[model samples]
Target: MASATRAGHRWLKWVGFLCVLCAIAFAVVWYARNANGNEPALNTVAVSRGDIQNLVSATGVLEPSNYVDVGAQVSGQLELIHVRVGQPVSTGDLLAEIDPTVYVAKVDATRAQLKNQQAQLADRKAQLRLAEIQFQRQQNLWREDATTRESLQTSEASLASARAQLAMLEAQIEQTSSTLRAEEANLGYARIYAPMDGTVVSIEARQGQTLNASQTAPLLMRIANLSTMRVRAQVSEADVGKLQAGMRVYFTTLGDAEHKLYGELQYIEPTPEVTNNVVLYNALFTVDNQEGRLLPQMTAQVFFIQEEALDVLRVPVSAVARNQVKVLDAKGQPQIRAIETGISNRVYVEVRSGLNEGDQVVLANRDPRAGQGESRAAFRGMLR
Candidate 1:
């Protein structure tokens, strides 16, 4: 009977021990849940000085700063194309030639007519000289009463006819000379020359191609100076108002995104281009292309800088909320403070005030010990 009582006492002791263990486990879980356990750890960043820019983005095309279309001023068959596409040329360089056979023949005909007019003028002058001499002789004879009045009168009429004939010949010679000059000019136009220093960008006329410049000058080729390039950026209507003349801008080519070519805004066209129901304005700028890297009609990714702050206090945009920021004190405790921001690039913002250099800005807060102390399943079960 004593042995049975001792077994019962041992059973009770085991039960009590199990109850105590259950109470201890419950207490631990309750403490873990109530002791700021669910709070997230603090993510922080240091306030530092950096560069920031407020920019407007747009697309553009590169074109030569100066360009001209070389055309045929007079009509003829294209005899030669002295330059190929991309050939370099200077002013007065012979670019090409039209078949000058017709022009040459016209010039020859005009020249021969001019010579004929000169011969006629010479013959008329000789006749006028003879008439004047005879009239003088008649006057002298009349004064001496050695010639009849009728004969003197006839001589005077002859002199006047000769003078009229000479004047007519002179007018005809002048008209012929003017015609000759025009024909000579046409002959010269058969040979085309570069009017400016540039590279031949295009050739519209080929060898032996017939060109008729009567109505419009036939486009023979195009020449452009590639030493400087102009960027024509298409700015959206919403952003075009923010742009102004003489502002700084830069661009990058699709093939070379890493390298930026910069320039100042030159002009903004008053007209807008309506494409696919989108209104876009043209903003122009020029960039020095001494390296000859830019080409005509190349695309550019452009940025127009509105405002910029250099070597200024800055922080990530996420760190600032509602013109206020949470900064960690020296003791690593977060405290909210009102802030003033200047320029923002959507990624980083300029910290105008309320944040000191090297100050820790708390992005957010969390419990650092939450993950370490409990398994995911245990924490979940405790919550349930």
Candidate 2:
């Protein structure tokens, strides 16, 4: 009985060992299948003909191409403002007026002084003529032996003195005339006129306000020619070197993003502005505003087109790495190909050479099947 029991126990142990081996085999097969399924493959995109533009973006403010701050040159009470803000004015049009009372009185006084000097000059000339006649008569009398030598000498001395007085009066008249002209100019300043054709954009002085222009000219108003607008774009110092005068640029205002206004780069300021340790330079461009749509101080999103390519072979920028691209050749094998690129817009890069429109380029390495396997493995882990 003992021998039979021992044999039966040994058979039961063998059966348990076989069951363990089966379980181990099943686990190995499951793991191998999942591991094989999780292997990744290369992802790719096709090269195609498309347009790409390389641009530098910046924010800027719009301003008038031509603007001026009209000021009062002479001090007086601001009597009238001929043009209101937003009013269109032509050159020489009256813009404002100061009280002409003081200027007119000054002009009158200067004119009177000038006239007095002229009358004095005429009197001096009359006296000079009389003296010359007396001197000549005295000389003739002396030659005829009718006058004494002393009398002739006295007459000559008197003539010389009269001539000197006349010369002095003439100089005085010239000085007075210059003063009169200056007073007249000041009188004209009381009536301020527009220096150019534009619209009044600002008014700094009000009627009845007293202006003291003894030191600095008092600002009265500002005029802006809205026919053309300029955008002052601040670009980073790093990008400023790429900008050049006459390069094509376009901008859109916050209010009118649908419409784009184009212009050429007019200038790039040599000096840079530093803000928070970052340097920026101002780039200027002008655009026509005939429709009066563009206004001063309007914020704009500016684009400087550095380069562009149209209907050229292009591919995903991600496909190009370090001036080379991983391309799938005719044999469907990945190979590195050196390529020349022209313009890139962050997403698409223009292929200048060494690539064809129908060729495929590897953008990234991705495996959709591996993702599924990972999901299944995660599920199995959660079940465990």
Candidate 3:
């Protein structure tokens, strides 16, 4: 019985030893699997350096390069309107006409007065000729003792009076002629004509409208050249300093936000406009309108191309690590790097320094899927 009990104890000890060995083998395999955790699931981008440019944006209005205010020089009832609004006209094209009857009557009356003065002058000259002949005959009679001293004096007085009368009439003729010419000029002013070669943008006077030119010329209409347009952009004081002539610009009108037009900066006003205590500078640009699509006073959104870059390495601004970037070192281990940045359009920042061509820059990591058992195992190993 003692021998049998000793054999059972030895068998129990062997079984316990086998169980411990199995546990040790399982732990070795588990550790080996855990040690090879899945690589970090990260998004990366290649870094490269290249040129970049900056820009500033603003808003403005479109206007004509040249505009004119067509006005009435004479006050009268508008008898007729020869042109309609937006009609193209050339210089000397009759735009409108005031009733010329009154002016014409005045001219006729002044001309009649001038003719009357001329007739009186002619009559006076005839009388002078008769008086001169009598004076010469009287002088001959006095020399021959056939006339008295009183007769000779009377003839001389008549001659002098006739000469004085002729002088007065001639002076009257000159004065009346001047008045007639002035009246004729006033009559001519009744016809209104275009002063420039452009389109009639507006018509302030309609048929039968009375114009008052006693004080102001009474703006009858406005004319503008639409072939070329100007964009007068009021830039903020902050961005105005960077604006210069010859810069590239583009703008879109307020109409449906539909079309975009390109132009070059032509001028920048040296003085700033102050309204309600706010200061703004005026920047002007020119755009061709061969299509005639642009109109006056159209609000425009403007962009000034201050700088630009083409075909360069770029990355999302969010991918750039704050204060550092971790990159693989020469030994293939992660190393922290300092970098300098350049122009950013708020979406991407130009990496100007501390990176190389085709270098991988780490971005954000996404969450693993629910069924990613291998990934979970890797994650657990990393935590351990």
Candidate 4:
């Protein structure tokens, strides 16, 4: 009975081992058949002829094309402000007025002095005429031997002295007239006038404020033309070389959420600005604002349109492998071809010398059969 029991136990153990082996083989075969069956192939787009533009983006500010600071030319208390901030003014429009009482008085005094000198000059002219007549009569008498030589000499000397006095009086009148003109000019400066046609943007001088013009002219107000504005964009020194005058550009202001302004490049600064270890060059362009939407100092988002290709062959940048594009040859076989690329904004690299429109370029592996699943798994593992 013991021998029979031992044989049965050994046999049951062998049977159990064989069943585990069969189960392992079945699992291996199942995994081999289903491992990569459920993934889709890559999606590709055909290269087509279309317009491609290379652009550089930057930020800038909108400023007036021309702005001038209206300043006080004469010193006095500000009595009146004829224009308010944002008021449109024409050239010679009254901007402000300084207290002109003192200047007017100075002008009056100078005019009185001038008038007095003029009256004196008239009297001198009369004296000169009388002296000329006397001298002529004395000369006639002397010629006729009726007057003594000494008397004739005395008359000539008197005439010469009167002429000298009259000339001196005339010089004094001229000096007084110059002084009067200067005083009048000063009086005119007391009333400030707009130097250009623009809108008042700033008012630094207040009513009753005293301005001192002994040194620099004190700022009174600022006038700017808002109908047209300029955008001063800073392009990096590296990219500035690509920008040139007359190139087209577009910009959007932060305030104008939906509108974009287009313009041509106007100017480029030869010098670069170095700030915080970065160098940038200034680029300028003008935008028309007939709608009166743009304001001075408003931030603008700028784009420099460097190059544009129209109706040209273009493919996704990723479609190019190793700077070489892979496409199906005439025989429907995979082949690689070298291509020359043009300006790229890093998103779409333009194919300049290779491939034509309607050619198919293979994009990166989206194909499930191309071992992408394993690649993705490896990538995920690396991330962890």
The best candidate in terms of lDDT: 1
Q: Count the backbone clashes (under 3 Å) in each candidate.
A: 6, 0, 2, 3
TM-score of each: 0.84, 0.79, 0.68, 0.79
Model 1 C-alpha lDDT per residue in residues 152-234, reported as the tens digit of each score: 99999999999999999899889989998998999999999999999999998889999999999999999999999999999
lDDT of 3 at 46: 70
Global lDDT of each candidate: 0.90, 0.90, 0.82, 0.85
Model 4 scores what on Cα lDDT? 0.85
Candidate 4 local lDDT, 222-282, one digit each (tens) = 9998989999999997888888899999998776657878999999989988999899889
Per-residue CA lDDT of candidate 3, range 1-384, in tens?
Answer: 999999999999999888767766775685566558745455667775564557778879878898899888788898998999889999999888899999999998998888888888888999999999999999999999999999999999999999999998888888888888888887888888888888988888779888888998988899898889999988889999898899988888877576768789989998998989878899998899777888998889998988766656666676677746767656555667877866667666776677777887776556444345785566557434
Q: Decide which is better by lDDT, 3 or 4.
A: 4
Q: Write the per-residue lDDT of candidate 2 for residues 1-384, one digit (tens) a residue.
A: 999999999999999888767766776786687678543456888899987888999889999999999999999999999888999999999998999998899899988988888888889999999999999999899989999999999999999999999999888888888988888999999999999999999999999999999999999999999999899999998888889998999999998798988999989989989999999999998999999988899999999999888899999988988889999888778899999988788799889899988898998645456466676577557444
- Stretches of model 2 off by over 4 angstroms after superposition: 1-50, 318-342, 351-365, 371-384
Off by over 4 Å in 3: 1-53, 128-164, 255-260, 275-277, 309-384
Pitting candidate 1 against candidate 2, the one with the higher TM-score is 1
Worst 10 residues of 1 by lDDT: 364-373
RMSD of 1: 6.2
The deviation in Å at residue 99 for candidate 1 is: 1.5
Q: Rank the candidates by TM-score, best first.
A: 1, 4, 2, 3
The order by descending lDDT is: 1, 2, 4, 3
